[model samples]
Target: MTDSTYQFTRAITRRPAASVVNGLRAEDIGTPDLEQMLKDHAHYVATLKSTGADVIELPPLDGFPDALFVEDTALCLPKGAVLMRPGAPSRMGEVAQMAPTLRSTYSEVREITGPGHIEGGDILVTGREILVGRSARTDAEGVRELTAIVSDWGYRLREVFTPEGVLHFKTDCSLLDGETILSTERLDASGCFEGYRVIHTAPGEEACANTIRFNNLVLMPAGFPKTADILGKAGFEVVEINNGECAKLDGGMSCLSLRF
Candidate 1:
């Protein structure tokens, strides 16, 4: 399994249920317009498939309001997948729901059984190293479990702390490739991205830090012109999508899919 985000061959995503407006959100950003959200999600899936990945589209789980953000439930690796136990108690059972899908594709599926809570969003798999963030959603035991599981997969592990205002580690950073990172000023100053070439999201476009690099195309949220300009100048082909609905629930480009 290479650490590069551009080396992925497949991805998994889920349809947002009608009850998505009931999903978790930090800032009371107003409710997501369900009708438009479905439209945007359809376009999102299309954009992902256009990147040449074999997209696994899962049906909506009406019982789980935030199930559309499937990346939080598990992680995809070259060797296998790890079913996560999300730190938010409300999101716990999502991991169990994702297991059948993982079993169908992976050979070495692992689980982070509590008193360990880890969400895929708090983990960054870059090249041969795995960076786990110590956040409200991922504790010390979670990081330890992640380390033990990834060690056998031949990955070097390191722990970084998520700043108070950030939701997840990846929320402020994304791998442009194995050697380059697109991040926000806050995270660049955190020392978690020392060895890589860190490109700060344009000053007012911090949300751009959550974009995803799939193969050569950068899948980013629309409405962030400055950051898009920077990425364009950096030589990445950008594919912007309207993420207003998803953003209402704290979701982003990477959160909607699990790529590997």
Candidate 2:
């Protein structure tokens, strides 16, 4: 395994048109104008690489169309890549497909399965603490099991739960930098992520909470002017990209791909 400060060597992304969203049944969201979607995805991939992050495009899956493939997951520490067991059943195939891609990039790759389903998006890794959100998507059994697996690496695991109806903790909160955190104002912070400086986004800027910290740069969804300004003031070079099409399917900048 490699010991280096979080350098994102590879990433995996899919075209939004191919994303599978379960709720929007009446409207044909999957069959949108793919030409433009492809164009946008290409631009996104290019921008991600421009940050010096290697980007790997996964071959599209045939059977599962509405897979919450990207956002509903997480990547393991060092070089032992543990593909998450996604909360949504439709996304199960994504982990299987992601395995080879990870093996091609890293030396060791593993899977978190059986009686313990979890998502990478719900797990936030700071200097030494690994904070996981136990919600509809991730369960206590999953967190305990994963913590045990990664304990040898010396990471402390903590669990937080959101009030009912909040899909994922990361959907409303994200660690922006070493000491800074971007979170939705509505989240209950009583015992969650204590001691870190909290930066609150505006009412509708909850989506902006999903920013990704790659190297020294922060990739944020374009259009949240206030959130961008806040991040900029905090000494992060913020790069904004339009994820309108992906956003329609409950996806965001961070949700579109995984960095490792």
Candidate 3:
């Protein structure tokens, strides 16, 4: 509805813990290097703060390997924040760990207490509505429950489908602006973004699809020169962060923080 979607005044991020080496992944690529992840994470936070926004850096959660991927824990909006119910049993506790911070940040907060599960990664909030894809981490019942909760706030929720084997809906797409989406060809072919301007990642650079547009800059994973060139040509200020370590854990720029 408002520019709060990308023009955020604040963001919440958690530092990666040593146990991040054991973070969940769709497949085992290689163990993530905590040292490298920390370095990249610092660069990320610093970049966010550079935009003159308040960035809250929460401490690491060693007990929870995927805690650094804070975006999966909640869906933050201008109206309020909704805590998600992750389908991953090991990741369910991450929601509770993120609750107190959100409760303190927003005047109103809601939770998805349900028989179904949904993770924030499966949701994409645009200027018009909320698009949620049913994935391994998100289900039909969870989408129905989320719709009911956000409906009270005058938000419309649309149910969509994640490509087979994708870890999350956002693994293949991201909003670059109110009406522009940066996506992979496979995901775009699904026709979900028909009404929006879609920018396909380079043929072999689909890994760069999971980026974030925060304020004046677009933070994307490094190593995708073609996509970066395309984004620059499109007038987006791009910042490339080395994602070698996080990539091993199936994480990207969007997973690092909760913007609002």
Q: Estimate TM-scores for all models.
A: 0.97, 0.86, 0.99
lDDT of 1 at 204: 85
Which regions of candidate 2 fall more than 4 Å away from where they truly are? 1-6, 17-33, 66-68, 71-74
Q: In candidate 1, which residue ranges exceed 4 Å CA deviation?
A: 1-4
Task: Give the alpha carbon lDDT tens digit for every residue of 179-203 in model 1.
Answer: 8888899888979888888888998
Checking candidate 3 for backbone clashes, the offending pairs are none
Regions of model 3 farther than 4 Å from truth: none
Worst 10-residue lDDT window for candidate 1 reads: 1-10
Query: Candidate 1 — what's its lDDT?
Result: 0.88
Cα RMSD to native, each candidate? 1.1, 3.2, 0.6
Model 3 lDDT at residue 96 = 95
What would the per-residue lDDT of candidate 3 be over residues 1-260, giving only the tens digit for each residue? Answer: 96667898999999999999889988998998889899999999999999999999999999999999999999999989999999999999999999999999999999999998999999999989999999999999999999999999999999999999888999999999999999999999999998999999999999999999999999999999999999999999999999999999889999999999
Residue lDDT tens for model 2, 29-58 = 463444565676677788778878777776
C-alpha lDDT (0 to 100) for residue 56 of candidate 1: 92
Candidate of highest TM-score:
3
